[model samples]
Target: MKKTLIAVAVMAASGIAFAASNVTLYGVIEEGVVLEKAKHGDTTVDLRSGFDQGSRWGIKGTEDLGNGYSVGFILEQGFNVDSGDEATSGKAFSREAFMYVNGGFGKLGFGRTGALSFAQSNAILTGWAFGTGYGLSSWTSAIGNNFSRMDNVVSYATPVFDGFSVHAMYSNGLTGDSEKWSDNNHYYGIGVKYQANAIRSSLIFEAADNKGTATADTLVSDVLTENQWNALKQTPAWSTVKDDVVKAGTAKKKALYVINYGFEYNLGSWTPMFAYQFAHQNQGRRTHMFGLSAKADVAGGNVMIGARYLFGKDKATKVGASELSVDGDVRAWNIGAAYVYPLSKRTALKAFAGYADSGKEWKNVEAVGYNGYQVYLGMRHSF
Candidate 1:
């Protein structure tokens, strides 16, 4: 009889423990067909995944500790639904892997997660109207190098006061180096957000310290015009110049910084959003960007339209105390629209089209110039 009673007591304790904890599994799958036209008149049609949003699966759990305190964790992974491959090679949880504690003192988090700037941009900037997918908002904001996530981060969010809150984060090393404490790839960010009845606004500042030499090819290519680059490549002194450029880059580390501001106003069926960003680097590079967007509810669906413009200033690359003129000025614009119709609470059909012009200045940099248009028809399901 004693043994039977002890067993019952143990079972009761188990049940109580289980009641304090909750777990959930969730996922989003998006797939679409896309028609793309390249700058040089090349055209392609293909099936794509995650055009609207990244296809992902995740697990999350929370343990209530009573007294208005709780602990939770999330592990999310992204994948390509069309090819059945992980979004990031060799990584299982690429999107988010973090844990947090919440209470009256606000929330504290650790591990890999979205950066404060990224969160602010999504909450009050472009994401309110057009999702942060393949759109102008994303393109313009990318000039600031506002990465979505950082590794080895410690983050804190203050309790809201009158619809105002503050968030801050620091990453010891973003590259996952073995000696993280000594790694030079450090990131720091802080932001303020205000959300009230009909308006939402945010401002964020971020900085990063990167250590390492800019590649020889990048230095030479960026410092010279297309014709100059082609001519130099054919000269016998090209190798020597390239080596000198590498040495110069190696002598100085790059420091990057950016500031972002966003505002949105909601008026019943219509919402308008505006965002601005300024980015600068120690190498004398600077950029300014502006974005505008709106969303409206019509016919039991929502339609979104957005436009962005970006301009960059020219800077010179210094090699051994001599400045090499780099015509890096860029002017770019993009406009797009999307319509999403809900088939159910967790399912939606979406269609979008956009056009972008990288401008003549950006054509010199193969990585940035993309004069093209794309059209997509897709479906998204969430669970």
Candidate 2:
């Protein structure tokens, strides 16, 4: 009987190979032409891609190991088409690079992949790109998703049952203290999502206090000033900020908490979405963001509208530790609309424009409060 089962499995693998491949190649190329004017006297056309959905090319392969078991891996490369350079500096395999084994219980893998908070954040996205930097998940994915798919990591996912399942990840700290650590510089997230028909909902929770380089912004100043592309490196001013942030961690003996909650319902030609985001770090400084989004089909095209609100820490500590509020509160908002037409099956013609405003405040008031706006038009293609 065992021999018969083995023969049947080999046949199944062969059949699948003929239908599809044990290997695959896929990719997307996106570009955005943006013009902006800021209070800091910055005006220029920033041609971009990989900023929204991230542009990349990748290859993946899968193989049946045997009875209810399989294995697979992915190698992806991200790049910016405008400058013909690597995305996020020349970080090889920056996206996803992992190998996994599947079975009736679930699947286990190692390498880089998604984090709990990052996964939960999809709860709020309106299907639009995240280009504006976690605008949707401003509160939930605050620490950013990188900590989820970090290097030297292991993960596992349970088999889906009734549209519900769980996923978890752990990163091994090959460096730093906590040599006595079990999940040092490590983080974990668990989320539950349900999809029946026209309704969808997601709830996720995560915690981690990574002790190393946390997420930082892009080096726009470096790129624009030098007229060259440079990885967004953290500035010295950020050093102080980072220090405060670390206090939200364990090694630094600090922690940051964030949450994102959202839902959507399909209504024939449109689906409306609403989300709330919140983040609090160390001794009470807090930030909150909320967004409303909707999609509709009109005259053989798709239309989208999105608006967001951000409120930084109040003039007072509202939550965590004390004596932690430094820069005071920063508020921002953006409103935009886009119309996209399907030129062909693989190509799309899109024209979008939007306005963004930022309200900044310095605890000392002697410092400058920053404000800015932007306008953009762009197109994209994929292969």
Candidate 3:
């Protein structure tokens, strides 16, 4: 009788512990074959992984703390299916590793996390770009999706109320410093989102400062007149003086500011997205970008079309007593369709194709004057 009672007591304790904590393991696998072309380069075919979205596995758990409070944690890692290796070097949990506490007020998290702009604009961007194998090749190559993942972040999100919410985040910059208190690298971001029955919108602002060197400006002139060209060639003494001036201005504290807006509207069978962004850097550069895309529901999947434009200008640079202009623009367009045939609830097969044209002028840029085209067949399974 004594042994029986002890066993029952142990089982009861185990059940109670299980009730207080919950854990789950989840992952996705994606692989595909892609054919790509580059400007002035030969076509190449290769097997690829994570073309649509990165392949990753994650563990998440929550512990009930009683009284409308809970503690949760998540650890996710990205990997390559072909080589069976981690995506990032020297780091296991490269995607996300964070812990948070949630209650009626809001959720506060600490650790490494995605930037607010990335999180807010993902859904809207999906409405325009195929996001796989050169779908938004033009926009992404220049404006870069306006997203980045950062470490040493403290993030907070407010609970949704009346279809509105806000998020803010800050990162402590680079790690490993003898005097960490006076570190010069820091990042700050804030965003607001609104979701209604047919419309969704997000606004994000972010800034970063780091003590580093930047290519301040470049001078390009392919259409100079004969006299102008002659003057440039004859100013040997001026070149030496200008070189000294530029060298003295080399080392600088780099700073960047970004303002982004994204919107999506659903019209039953079709969804359209719009995006606008502006960026300014302390290195005398400015950029403006605009994007638009639409998706229409079709037979087992959807068809998408996306386009983007980027304009960049830099302050004139002095070269041999002459102020040279460095300004350029990039424009891209893409249209693709995907058919999804579902094998099961957690698996799907997709095939897609896209085309993009990007051109740059007066920038002396290399490998940039080609039209990109690609096609891919991919599969994704989640568990």
Candidate 4:
């Protein structure tokens, strides 16, 4: 079934690319039988949904703008393989949409893009090969270090020199109130990475000041309608989903910061990797995570074993409202292995099995119940 679907997708994509090769329409549609059993406070069944690799389809185009510069644009839409859901129930362009110009000097971009924190992770923490059963692996834990693909953002990335570079983004919060003292919501981040024949390393930092006078209630349930969302110069809703619960303060969480550090080392016969991330929410709450992963070739196939630990506390004091409560530890672990054998250049067979365990304490608060073991088989084809 996966093969048939891939063939159909390839044919459909080929028809569109038949006209020109300059534009590339490519994406990953990974779906299979995912059996989930949540037995903590309650027992239920939600056979399929995208929690690992997000199901998405994207179209990208680039044009030679001359003068050592080129302009490119990307429009992406996410779909669910299980129920064929679009992004989040009904968003047409839910994944991402952005435009940028690349040249000799640097890269200037506008629209929505991942934050610097996203780029600051180590290869092992990047979740590059973390699909399938490795749900609780280091890659999955790194999701917290991620940032919103900001909207109405003007970003500039400097050319790398000697394995080092930086990026700065400025967002204009048009809806932000003036009397609230929400200044220009600007963010700056810098990362320097060293990659050689056998090793790669990176460090990155991202910081933001709320400077917005938006009400705390909206910030908690901040997501407005999509049409209303797009009107602002740059709205915070782009990052926080409609259902994602937020706790707003009189000052808002406008002033937030996150930092991530990662590294990977390869030793011809085997390789190892490590990463650490820390996030501070305003002046009250904070969370930190550390992950380490590595595997080696055995019996002509690669095997991986990895783990991540996260500890966090959330605090908000209100006049009438009460403080949020959580107990036990906030930690999840996943260990899995996958073996791939090539049938052809673009075809391969993949089989993976994994076991993941998370805190049962927060089960009631979380939508997706925690703690279980999962196994799956997948086939991938590319053209």
Q: Note the residue pairs that clash in candidate 1.
A: none
Q: What is the C-alpha RMSD of each candidate to the true structure, in Å?
A: 9.6, 9.2, 11.5, 7.1
Compared with the true structure, all predictions reach lDDT values of 0.69, 0.53, 0.61, 0.52
Model number with the top lDDT = 1
Candidate 2's C-alpha runs over 4 A off are 1-21, 117-149, 173-184, 212-253, 312-327, 360-370
Candidate maximizing TM-score: 1
Evaluation by TM-score, superior candidate among 2 and 4 = 2
TM-score of each: 0.80, 0.70, 0.75, 0.70
TM-score, structure 3 vs. true: 0.75
User: Where does model 4 exceed 4 Å of error?
Assistant: 1-21, 39-51, 89-91, 119-134, 138-145, 170-188, 210-251, 298-301, 316-324, 327-344, 347-373
Candidate 3's displacement at residue 231, Å, is 48
Query: What would the per-residue lDDT of candidate 4 be over residues 1-383, giving only the tens digit for each residue?
Result: 45434544665776843232246666665554544443333433344434444567776667787888888777777787778768644445565667888899888877655565442111112322342234434243322444544445667777777756555665554222222233334455555556656767767676766444233323321344434534432556635542232222344564567777777778876678777778776544467776667767766656666666666754433211222254333554445565665566655555555555555333333222134455555555444
Candidate 1 stretches with Cα past 4 Å from truth are: 1-20, 119-128, 135-144, 180-182, 213-249, 314-326, 364-369
Instruction: Give residue 325's lDDT in candidate 4 (0 to 100).
Output: 51
lDDT of 3 by residue, 130-200 (tens): 43233334334433435456667888888898988887888875331222444324678887878889988
Which window of ten consecutive residues has the lowest lDDT sum in model 4?
A: 119-128
The residue-by-residue lDDT of candidate 2 on 23-53, one tens digit each, is 6666778777766654445576777674335
Residue 193's lDDT within candidate 1 is 88
Q: What number of clashing residue pairs does each candidate have, in the order they appear?
A: 0, 11, 0, 4
Prediction 1 global C-alpha lDDT: 0.69
For model 4 the local lDDT of residue 383 reads 40
